[model samples]
Target: MIIGYVTNFNLNQLDFNIKLKIQSDKFISSNCRKQYVKYLLDFEFRKNFHCIGIPIIKDPPKDSFVIGHHFFNDQENRKIGSYIFSYCFEKRHYVNLPDFTFNTLLILSHPKSGMLHFKDRNKRILFIKPKPKYISLCTSREDICGPIFMKQKANIIKKIDIEVDDNCEIGDNCICKNKTLKESENDLKFIYFVPKNTN
Candidate 1:
């Protein structure tokens, strides 16, 4: 299950869209998949914004889970962000967003979780499980700022300070910040993923 917002910031208006994708090998029949997709298409977490999910015929790789957000623009965006935030909180997961709103891929996943290969080695990537209060701050804004802000204001979510290693892999259920990949000299692109224990 993946959910996040995509933003297109223009001079006059901002195009905010919510997207979701659920890949499973258990959808046995095409009709079942189509119906599930239809359900997601019709389901509205907010009044006017509906989640968009593309159904695939082929099975996705195992233990796939990816999450991130782009930007928030209005009450609708906040509502959707809050929805995703609440879901993550209930499941004890984390959410991270960039510092600014730009054209970027917001979600990535694979069935078999291991080292992920990327064409762009210089891409800056950081993974952190922000404190719960900070997660709430992310869903209350209607502007073009990332989760980390320079100045603390009524709407700004302040930047979190934490020490990070040059390059390290974060384990499941760990809480840390600034574990960045861009700081490493080695071509390290792998993000190991262990399936969450549902039991």
Candidate 2:
């Protein structure tokens, strides 16, 4: 069962205001709760998995909430960064956030740059903060390659069907229409290795 989810409240940066929004009734609706589980891809974990316990982190807001979720990918580890903010805050409730009156959605949904900084006596502290600027199509090469199969440390790769067709439209001044074959087509299937602890 393919599952998709959205955070009820903004789970980004840890702030007091953000925590309040998360505790709002609007964020935890029955309809939303049901939808949250619908996107779960793993069947076994959904049925057999149980929470061991919850840890108490420092400075946790008095009105904060945390939720945990699990997913499955026996075939491949599909890129799921698209749901990072939402999943981190809402779906999994893996992080703590404060409720606020402002529109947390806008801040959380906005795109930002990726950068990091280090500040500590032993240089052990790393400040990985999102840049204020936003880029339109900041996708990764892996995204272009599409989804690759997830595997164990030495798991076997599955055969994926790649079909190319004549429907290829070159550029604005393309001139490959004269060929009797009409177009070129092919299918390429390959395999790669994954670590044992990836899952």
Candidate 3:
């Protein structure tokens, strides 16, 4: 079954250089596609097929959320990051989820440059913590800034068709901080169906 969840909180920076207008055209399972995307945002891990976190559009024109992912070394330390955050689908309703709070959300800088970033549904900057010197399940690193968690709100909506002009992220292409995409290059189209009210 297909699932939807938030990918990166920071839109501008994640797409900083390669500016391929974010659109949900396909399923991006973890460590399968877009290798660099692993550095862009944080998501939970699953042993089976990988998950592609499509960008979490607050409220897309119609309705769409992020679903994209990329590759990591698939190492033993994988649990280290997983401890910080876990994927919450409707099925796996685990109570261990960090206490849902307000101040937890803060913003750091240059995540691809460092530890991690945490953003809320409204796209507000949440926490900006780094990997801990002495890591644990609830490490001091996240305690100070705030932990980054990948929360998913799902429904019967299954597949979303995405079409982008070019599928490229500005890794080395974007050298400068002040980069912009022209109108012609900013073509991202998405079309999907949501189940109608069953009442």
Stretches of candidate 1 exceeding 4 Å from the true structure: 1-135, 139-157, 170-199
Per-residue lDDT of model 1, residues 1-199, tens digit only: 3356647534344223423343222233333321111111112234223222222324322332222322222454233331111002233333231111111111233221223222221131122112111121122233323222112233232333223332334443233332331222132122222222211
What is the full ranking by lDDT, best candidate first? 1, 3, 2
lDDT of each: 0.25, 0.22, 0.23
Q: How far is candidate 3 from the true structure (C-alpha RMSD, Å)?
A: 22.5
- By TM-score, is 1 or 3 better? 3
- Backbone clash numbers for all candidates listed: 4, 19, 23
List TM-scores for all candidates, in order. 0.17, 0.16, 0.17
Per-residue C-alpha lDDT of model 3 across residues 1-199, encoded as one tens digit per residue? 3267867554453433421112132222332332112231233232221222223423222222222222222334342121112222332221121222111111122222222111121231122122111111112111121222222223211122223224234443321111331111012111111112112
Judge candidate 2 at residue 152 and give its lDDT. 19
Query: Between prediction 1 and prediction 2, which has the larger lDDT?
Result: 1
Identify the superior model by TM-score, candidate 2 or candidate 3.
3
Model 3's alpha-carbon lDDT is 0.23
